[model samples]
Target: MPFSARLFCRPPRAARSRRSLSTRISAGVTALGLAAVTAPALVLLAPAPQAAALPNGLAATPPMGWNDWNSFGCNVTEQKVKSVADFMVTSGLAAAGYSYVDIDDCWMSGSRDSGGHLVPDPAKFPDGISGTAAYVHSKGLKLGIYESAGTKTCAGYPGSLGHEQADANSFASWGVDLLKYDNCNGDGTSPQQRDTTMRDALARTGRSILYSLCEWGQDNVWTWGAGVGNMWRTTGDINDSFGSMLSIFHANVQLAAYAGPGGWNDPDMLEVGNGGMSFTEDRSEFSLWAEMAAPLIAGNDLPGSSAATLSLLGNRDVIAVDQDSLGKQGTQISSAGGLDVLTKPLANGDRAVVLFNENAGAATISTTAAAVGLPASSGYTLNNLWSHVKTTSSGAISATVPGHGSVMYRVSTGSSTTTGTTHPLVGASSNRCLDAFNNQTAPGTKIEIWDCNGGANQQVTSTASGELRLYGGTQCLDATGGGTSTGTAVELWTCNGGANQQWRLNADGSVTGVQSGLCLDVTGGDQASGNVNGTALELWTCNGGANQQWRLG
Candidate 1:
């Protein structure tokens, strides 16, 4: 339920296999691809190769922004780009985390300069890319430029194949923050080598640039992209059509395990505001992209976009899940007869569930909290992200999703872990209890220190499942992002029974995260500084300090 060639279009298919041997081979490849397409919920490819994450700290979450390819193609201009950047801020897109304004292709001159330096087309970009980038930066945004790995780009502009370092230098000098290195006009070399070459070249520039590989999923980019680029295209270009969007989703959804903090599996830029899809289909595209943790790069005419388009692009609550610090991409949990369910685990232990109906008519899709991996609870809170509607469910999560539409919810478990028995988790040095920010039961709410007032939000229950439940057992003290590193923020999230939510109450008055083995400490509060109310909690090295100690009674 879950869901090139030329213009990067392949040559017309050779005449269908005429010989028996050729027919068999053709059928075999078709069957393999069909399995991946139709059985998206369970199809698993052979394990991808293990690779280190790119050292670049950019894209700790999937990148959110806009690209010019899907809408403008080669008609991009500096004035159009500047206007979109202006709209990005004025329409609240930048505030909602859409930062990069990308120029897809054709921004370069038809030929390189006599000095061997790449040049922006003076006619298209009168002030040069550096000046345009300065203007974009002035508005608190970043600029992305596109190039190709081969001798020429998809549009036949000079590529970076033999000029990697020089082009990287030119880009860095122009203040480019992101590079969409495409797979057009390449030599016979492997994709990995070409992409990695650019990766190293970008590093040599000494600027933190996010590298995006547009290899069209050839060479199984996901297997090695983490070490080379921030995000790699897992499919061919996307068109402004429902059929095209659905096919891309099917191809990209099954590769979820390969995406994370430093690298993401890109399904290609979004076509949300394009005229081809209906409003419902557009919303479905946006929801599915966020659900899959794909980059939210808008590929529409932003300056001329309708109000509906702006609202869909600027939904912060939906964006939060895609940009969640956990960096886990959602996967299809169930798919049958065109009804699909996808679940993504958030940093605060909440699960984002999307019920999508791919059929021609609306249908009711159902799945339970337990099925989606939430801990058992007396009730579950379902916050409809698109509709902003709230509902309670004992366990089963169901909704009537419209045809070619999706209904997304931020689901949190509300069942008490224990039967009316709870105790306070008090800071050993501060003598203040752990409290949910503002007593809010929402996922991702900050966990802080507060006076021990016997409030339900401070009542903790050490459950058999290894979770320290609070908020009358609805919330858990979670290590943000499941991070095993020191200084990771601690928060109150819906109890999902994840390792990050598991804590050990040691005899030394310390509460240490089971995943990180780091003691919970009052942020910036030591014996000399004294812990105070509302101080945030974080995981720190276990140094036997009083600030790192806790008493659970």
Candidate 2:
């Protein structure tokens, strides 16, 4: 679906090369404790505060469903969609949380009726979309239709540009529960204005329609999209290829902060079972998509799909990560030479870690619990979602991943009293403590070096799971926007267990971020004479500088 032979005005997105970065599990056990310690009584923390949902009351979590574009494209028919809905229920996809049976572009006729109402192709949809919706509803599933905001859809069908109200009414009358509004041959107006028009029109119909904006990530939709639609595309269309899927993944993963409850940043539909990639690649795609908390709109042949495809799609553990109550999108903890680690914080205070390998051969990927943001414990449990294998580790989580494959683990602890130790991170050069600016705990509060005052804010805990927490494990030291480049600022934020929050105190006294592999440095304080108090902290190349050296007790 990434390309259409009869394409419209939309231009294809250029490909992007993967970032060069590597992962290091680090000798965290030595840094935390050189000797084996007794396990503490397990006591989990209360769930984190839930994110705000869109006022429209739809998609409190990312929507999971099926779209026909990637499979049948313009060949969609009422029978095909209805059969797919049936397959969704029988195949356990509906029970697994896939509800929408969407018919993308070309479902309508080439032109509108005299009354300006969009018409369904009689031959392909003899009973019309309403009839199909009725059948889908009887199966306890929702129906979704696609339309373009311009004069025509990608397949050259009539669009809803000037006929927003009429089209919305028709859809609402047809019992459509969701609408995928795309950008094709749009009017000269801005995408924001055009998309908002359809949004308001859908709302005016008095139906609880889930609006999906498919502008292909243009106009910075993620920034203002929560106010307009349930989910907005964060990239161009995806095809059933590893390269294409990987490109879209890179494009959408960095926009994690823009996605959560109510609205999400869509990275297009799933390409599993399409045969363009190997089974390993397909599983990797599913794992990465769930990790990112992106919508799991499967776009493949249901009846003809292999059992392995169905099993992968029905993996409840992975699906749970996608539907996690916290709605936090996972971020890259480390990636280099095709080996990547990503982690997402669950509502139950657990972390979901994915060891992904993009190389041509099997490779070993590693990280620590403290690096992934788990509370320090004598031991942690790792639940492999794909293999259904349960294992225990002191703090290290490592796996040999196949080429273009991934290993996802739900990392948690059995109740423990040894949560972690809190102490000051005193700069070896300045002899000052790393402090949160003004003792504030708000996200993005400045992280600076300050005089050692023994304030609670100065107490930093290097948890077994790799998080550097402040204020009794309430706020974490985070890399701004998960940037890996030099000079990325470090700040205080709620402990979301993201890779950016994971840090390592090396044997030589240098502190590095598990995600960026960059040393935690006092900005402009690379020399023996460190910067003055209130000097901000940033991630910089590891040079073994005095400012980058910290002593913890």
Candidate 3:
């Protein structure tokens, strides 16, 4: 999250009249403060409530749909938006529950009308804002608009920096129901000033517009974003590829505590419809986002979506995870090389577990019921979201996850016997070398094996998979596969499930390939504490030395 610049100012006051107005204002403020203090401490102390009512007390989840900026950019037009809207209704997207039709950037002309108001580009939106909004509404969808906090938008168009009121009124008059407010050019001197400006503007609109603050996690927006807007983007702009998506998603795990209720921590829009990534990555992206409680705004040409895209987007069980009434965002409970276990509390008193393989090769991620914070001896009724299959278990749930894929299961208390065998070194362990591995690996690079000492470099975890992850739905790690020869580089690659991803820790503290049987040996047999890049590796004798021993905790 970015920090806002601070602004210092004194309150304006007139000598005599100022004294009277100041006293009244101070009293009102004091009274308000006292009222807040007098309220039940739970109401005040509890993290912000997630269940604030929306307009009309609507009980349904927010409608899902597509936006155009990501793929088409400044090329968005009325015909294009209308076609997408029509497609939403005709392609079964509307019936499947997506309802918002949004226009991103560069749709506006460089000037306002005679009324000193902003105007859409004549060629792009010939019928004007209201006309386009009506056309979208006619398609049984809501209309969404975009603006920047600075003087100019991403495309250098007019922004809402000093004209929040004007823009808010304009949006409301145009029948706009959603606003994607970007942080392009704002004098965000402080958190209070930046948030207050946007909040006050949205409140002034009178009409209940869903304010989406695109501030990219600045100022811990998730903690207080509900007071400012309906949702806030927690990361920078997202790309259409899986690596970018995973990178963004894994980076925001700590921010999960800030998301709930009417406010959410956005990981940016969906990249499902974009064709730059593999099909498995698309599925992983969808699954991870839903698991994280992210807004499901599609960013693609909806009119020409394929069946696979539709199937992925229209998965009801996955969508339910995203729209869980409990509004809790899932967090990373454990991770190891290119694999992760994420858990979220569901509305029905069950828990959703997503076992993700973030490496280039297939990998196994296992966890006992106790390790997942569940009762040791209790059975769990497991329902697979993707396959819609049911299974019963009492001890641990373990599965081999495909590279860049996930296994999503809804687990509830049940009566069943535990029947799974536990890996000798896998129950619960931690590794310090994992940190060294993450800090040293780069994209398209080789995973270098080195001598492990009891120092931070040698400790390994069997509890968590070793996959490095990004917050939200972004991907960042790349495991090219175990090398054919010793000293081959182990580097990070965009997540594509492949054999190169599998890593295992033997009981004697050695890390080996799950597929190749090659051990991860320290380069040059160097037991030196501060090993740097360009370190070479060769097959060496395993002596169960501290340098060779690793523990996963």
Clashes of each: 10, 17, 66
For model 3, residues 69-176, the per-residue Cα lDDT tens digits are: 766777888888888888888877787777778888777887667776788898999988789899999988988898877666655678776777888898999998
- The lDDT, on a scale of 0 to 1, for candidate 3 is 0.61
Q: Write the per-residue lDDT of candidate 2 for residues 490-540, one digit (tens) a residue.
A: 999999989999987553346789999999988887543446889999999
C-alpha RMSD by candidate, in order = 17.1, 22.4, 15.9
Candidate with top lDDT is 1
Q: In model 1, where is the ten-residue run with the lowest total lDDT?
A: 3-12
**Candidate 2: residue 227 lDDT (0-100):** 84
Worst 10 residues of 2 by lDDT: 19-28
User: Candidates' TM-scores?
Assistant: 0.70, 0.67, 0.64
Off by over 4 Å in 3: 1-63, 188-192, 373-378, 415-553
Evaluated at residue 146, the lDDT of candidate 3 is 88
